[model samples]
Target chain A: MTEGEFKIIFTGPMGAGKTTAITALSDQECVSTDVVNTDLEQCDKALTTAALDYGHIDIPGASGVRLYGTPGQERFRFMWPILASNAAGVIVLLNGQHPDLDEHLSTFVDAFWEGGRMPMVIGVGRLSDDDFFTIDAITEALVERNINPPVLSVDVRRKDDVLLLVEALLCQIEVNELGLAEA
Target chain B: MKQQRLGFVGLGDDTASACLSMLKIMDGRSGISWSLSDPDAADVLMVANESTDETRRWEHTSKPRIVVYHHNEPKPSASHVLQHPFRVMQLLSVLEDVASLLAPTQSQTPLKTDLPPSSIQAGAEAADVGEFWDSLHELLYGDFPAAAHWYVAQSDEGELWLDARSRRFMADPLLLKRMMHHNIRPGVLRACNAPATEGAVACSLFAMSWMITPHLPAGLSSWISADSAFQLLRWPSFGSLAKSRSDLTLCALLTKKALTRDQVLSLSQAAEDDTDRFINACAMSGLMRYDKADLQTLPGVSAEAAGSRFGGLIKGLRSRLGLSA
Candidate 1:
């Protein structure tokens, strides 16, 4: 029997729009494990996805895909690998306004990078025209680790934008499978 | 699990059952994973020893084969085989051997200078923009003292001011679009000491360089030396730029490891000009490094992950979303 169901992960620091991205693509409303914010130092949001975000897309004729978003807090680090295991790929979203933009990028990239075995695409939200070039730093950082995946500027509110990340993830997987049919 | 398709030919239903059972028994422990498939679609074939018809039917195929022999029958292939009543380790051993054969392409292989490079296939004829663009390219990619701070590109339509240090430039969006669409009249770019100090579309240095690629001449780009091996320093954003299929494949391959121009041609399903254009885009965008550094990309999918479930799943997801792979 085919393992028809697949998982794609959306993860990043708090308020990076994991839920918003999922909601953009999900067939139904995303199920979130929300908690009143206690850690205001990390983010100023009223609520946070403390456990995970769950959503699904119904494939036309096959068992669909499951989308999981890891909690943004470092306290939930243990869940990252568990969620990543057997995932098709990951989308690491980042808050471009955050002061520690580089740090969050480094942390999530290091955490889920999994030695580059995991295919990842990064989407940075709210990238202003003045700071458009900072995206290069994110791209270079991945290169420093000897990994280069697509780093796109995105707005999670746009369904097309979120889908671009998904499409890129699929491209990443197909590229990895390039020699499959070769003799 | 490293998945590859295993097909059976002329095995009795009982023997097929035994093989599948043994495969399941070895699951998690078997370094190479197998899913049952028809012989036509299989990556490697396991045939019954006495099945001459089946063996003859597959003789012409380049797909690797392993003969299943009874303890008494003579082996056809010297290396790959299956003893009757498959043992878990024995099946694992044969699969691992086949996996090794299908691997090594993805592993680290030093660049070879001996291999013959195909002649550059002619693409579109050189446009009038080559002279003007090439000079700007020289200044952009080359090291110069006056250009130490920056340079402003002067053209008939508008001025584009660029800062090499910041990877940013300022130009009118309509002018940039006209350039990208190849609608701008052919003209030379003149250097002005003072950068544009007025209203215009602020853009990444990559955007203008990438946008101007189509208007540039097509062939092996001079920037990527034919003799030296190179790889990407970073991937350019697929954002805001047109991405061809060739672009994606080249990005996927070069991002993993350094390759000579021909090496890239041999490995990718891209045309010579498309390859040149893709590399040129990377170079002008400051995403390509000339000298090859020791780069290692893991063989994420071993020996036809296309034959595996995960590979199928990825394609399926793309298909479901109405996106072509």
Candidate 2:
């Protein structure tokens, strides 16, 4: 039997720290090529995850969890379906600096869930110390969208912090899987 | 909201046919009223002609209103229309220009504004008007890109697609011949010695420029035709292998700010290089510029954020080179 490996995908708008979040928690070696964006948006300063980033981390000896990060720019919207199909769950990273979190979430929903069943999601609220966002504030925003996806504050640069959130998300995924099996 | 009727004086039967179609479409819409008349019945006339005699005839007569649609071809007489009438307007390359001009009233809107209104102002501008000609060109096997090389469409999905492929056939008569030149399409070699159809040349050039334009010189940043942009990319001596696919260059240029003026000049002068020519065209067109104000207005990531991304890459490069941060 193939060892049970849970696949997770990371996505969000451009500049939302998806790559940083995955790298922080990934236990196995991760491969990444971060570069600047210079499209019409003039987003040259935004760190873009060029190719898909992958990390294989053991889920505390149960099995190894795999995480993949895809680019969030609209121009790359063509690749969303491929990423969505491979994912068992998702982590949406919000830049918090933006005032339109709800709009952003709606766009993501349109991109990933418009045609099929939505994936299990965990709303990772980035920029914790920033005045504009807090764990509670991010939670409320997710709940408003009927997402209620285990919203939590996450600094993508920290390994342990990202792990805590991932562990919580895995538990939610397990409960969801159990519910589905029973149904 | 005063509406006006449009006319064609000395316009060839082909352009007259296209203008007639545009008139029919406008007639169906509310608030804009229009009718197409032979030069005799028209209150406002749009004249397009190649013959100097035909052009001079329109010049002497002053209709209360007139717009000159000059059919610029490779023939030497193509530029002669410039001598006609200042009040004359060029062909409405896009329907939005036609609608806005023909709709009339209030402010004095100058006709034939060099760049199409879509790039500067945003409104129903709706389905690219060029789609009609593009499809027609496909049907007739006419070289559409060659005929309307200046038209660039800003895709609703926010990507750029080329309509005309003129840049492929027309060597940059304005530039020196020795520049390293090539078309800018991703993965395709620009310096192909084999002759290509004007359409293929246009398609390849546009595909390359659309990708390279985002990483163009600070002076150039807005959407521009691949041919024009290829001219700019030729300024930079250093050429990237990107072929302008998926805007990879934009990402790299914004993040790294890796290109130099000397490099830009070389690429700009590289007549063989399409990406270099394209980057230069955008910069020259004022569509692409380094204005912080314009940068702030872009829909995604802030200018400051974009700059910092470059700063980080520069810092990394500096450290590698043992230079001060």
Candidate 3:
């Protein structure tokens, strides 16, 4: 990875609002691959990101900072590592209300875990105060895998929440750099 | 006695007026007299939940701060807190201790903004901390498991009903919150026969155990077996608990691989005592388990290489994005 060229990847399961989160950060409209949805059982959203979503933040002195959102379905699993490579970090967003949240958490977290080399932040959205899948409960699913990234309760509809995930990912990056330095 | 100047910050008008009235009522007291002043001018501060700005400004200062919150419980941080309409005696007791804390001293640290309320110290908490944890240890891990399945942790705030088998508890959210947000402990645990009652919030023992770490009596010393490796079994939900940013960072590092105490200390670059405290919190919370796996020989990237390469970029991103810790 070039010194100033670091991209942050935003990947999650279906209906987790990756495109919206990317759009929230990207100075321009987030470019996405939206197609008519046939997999209603997987996610009931009318449009699904079929390929990948693309966005960028203009960072000075470097090849711009790119934001990539990988397709949520298993078929596009190939895109995850492609986007993850040379990336500074990844943000794993999940629909807290999804019945398959535990599996989604395990699958995405396992894919991007990186043994802590790359920073990851987990944002669970659409959870109400009374939702059964509280942030702590979601964190427990990762416990079985022994991966301990920051798990935050967030709503991607708000730009601040998206920024929070970005901030958290930065914190993680700072920590990783610090850890590597100390090592 | 020198009158201590107290200040209020981010308080509701009604709450501020009530505090002034309460101060007037205590005018005749012989202990350290307090005079309310602007937060910046006061020797101590009575802060509402908007403690971030004030705390960041005074992070290195030796002033005592009591977070005073009304309505719902404030965010679960702050070492010293007093709920609104606090009883006169409670206020007096807290004032007396805080006054002692403000008295000239080097060995003691004033109430740290980062510590949990349970770890709150006013001058001399070390004396009671051992006894506190000893009773708690006996309650949770006593030799006789069959002796009691339920235990009640009674403190100045309220009781937490514990199921010893599950290492979980049920407690009034308000009451438990006071123990967490106010400068108080869950007190010691005593065996009880009744099950956790209907209304209290059910929580993992880690939720309870992690709060006592900053005040443990032996914090300056090491608890780790020099040669043994440490790895986190799970990350305590910091979002659900009282913790500082460093706590999150440490948890992230440990969950990645088993590291020796020295390695952790070196990597974290935290003071020995601080490192010990984090390890203690993880161990006490049962989040860290004995893992003897020597460092999984991940290619040793010199810490310098990684730091130097990404340092400026991170700084630029944080600055350009206006992100602050």
Candidate 4:
């Protein structure tokens, strides 16, 4: 039997658009723990998420996806495992325009998959102009770590784009289930 | 196809031979072909080992030159410089660039390369074929030892089914090649829903392959044909398998329109193969999509509309936070 409930966590470094993505995809008005930004050096956004962003979406005849976004700042990283508890998959949102994108991706991938393996999908945002963090470079990074998750470009503000990430996660779950069943 | 005359200067016989082999691999794939010619008659000159006399001679010539240098050696200031022990794709890219510089008008043709015989024929010698299968099997299953079943969307005796083991499908080399090139995994098959009809299976296979391989088969090349329109699936990330800055430039240009290959090449100094490689890499990474329809004419979200939406969201946030905007 197919699973009915999926809890997926959205994570990445600062300015990755997690909050905006949750707000875009959430059926209910998203619940965000955002506060006035104090760390201007870290990010230039007016506000920053301090705790988590919460949302949910229901798909007919399949699992209802519960979306959670982790605070991008490292100070609140203690909440990562807590939010990721019982997560069916992970959606890592990265800022492609950031100079430190490759390092940020490596750090997050290490953190998320440290204890165990989980299916992941990487969504890169703000990839306008001559951005350096490409999908293949991200894929290469993941492949280097023996992780083969799907990497895509996404404008998190678009609901359809966010949905695509969720759908990809669900597909990953189904694939994992089949592998287990066959095994 | 028009043959592009190439002249070699100061290159060792081994390096020259290697270049010829690389050209052979790239032959019939692109509109341009390469043939050795006299220096004066050549459209492009390849220089190696820093032969001062030869460099001096070529300096007066109008032909575009590609300098070959050792990795540790200081690369010459040339329009193109290929490192020693270059990969086939890298060499092809340089050649394409030189071709574009030589004859801009002729470079617009959609590049196509002939597939190696080893990639297609399933009826090769048993021992040689077995070795190929073993290598491919090792690549796929060796990394994931726990993956017991691999589902392929190919038919065997009209039976469309999953093969739990690689050895069970040794007779089908094409399937094995696909598995290797596409890096096909159990996840792909499950996501695609295996055991479907033949057409569905082929479509799924193509979709999955496009998501992986850096190169597409000839059959799939039409999707990005020079006349057909294409759009980026998403914005390009610098992290792509793209080998040069021109590739990224092409990627950025592609995001705004459903451009043809000729249009894309004309916009940037990137050659057809480089652009093709960039497109294929983007497609494999799920960054682009191609269609026959011209999507540029379709209505899209305006910058003003997007800005307004963000502006409203910020205003609401400011109000909620009791902050003046």
Docking quality (DockQ) for each candidate: 0.12, 0.02, 0.10, 0.03
lDDT of 2 by residue, B192-255 (tens): 1123122221122322333344333434223332222121121111111222211222322221
Task: Highest DockQ: give the candidate number.
Answer: 1
Error of 1 at B5 (Å): 63
lDDT of 4 by residue, B1-325 (tens): 7788899988877678777765654555445778888877888888885768876777667778888998899877877999986655467668856766777543344332232323222332222322332323332334433132333322222222332321122123345334444433221121012232222222121232233343333222333455556666443333222224454345445543566665656554566666776665455434566666565564343322322212332233324323322
Winner by DockQ between candidate 3 and candidate 1: 1
TM-score of chain A of 4: 0.87
Query: Which is the better candidate, 1 or 4, if ranked by DockQ?
Result: 1
Name the top TM-score candidate: 1
What CAPRI-style quality would you assign to candidate 4? incorrect
The CA lDDT at B168 in model 2 is: 21
How high is the CA lDDT of each candidate model? 0.69, 0.41, 0.67, 0.56
Clashing pairs in 3: A180-B303, A181-B303
**3 or 4: which has the higher TM-score?**
3
Q: Write the per-residue lDDT of candidate 2 for residues A1-183, one digit (tens) a residue.
A: 133545677888777767777766566667776676665242336467666778765543345556788777767777777776756567666654343454566677557653323434444444422121133334444434544444444566765445544544443333233222110
Tally clashes: model 2: 57
Best by lDDT: 1
- In Å, residue B18's CA in model 2 sits off its true spot by 44
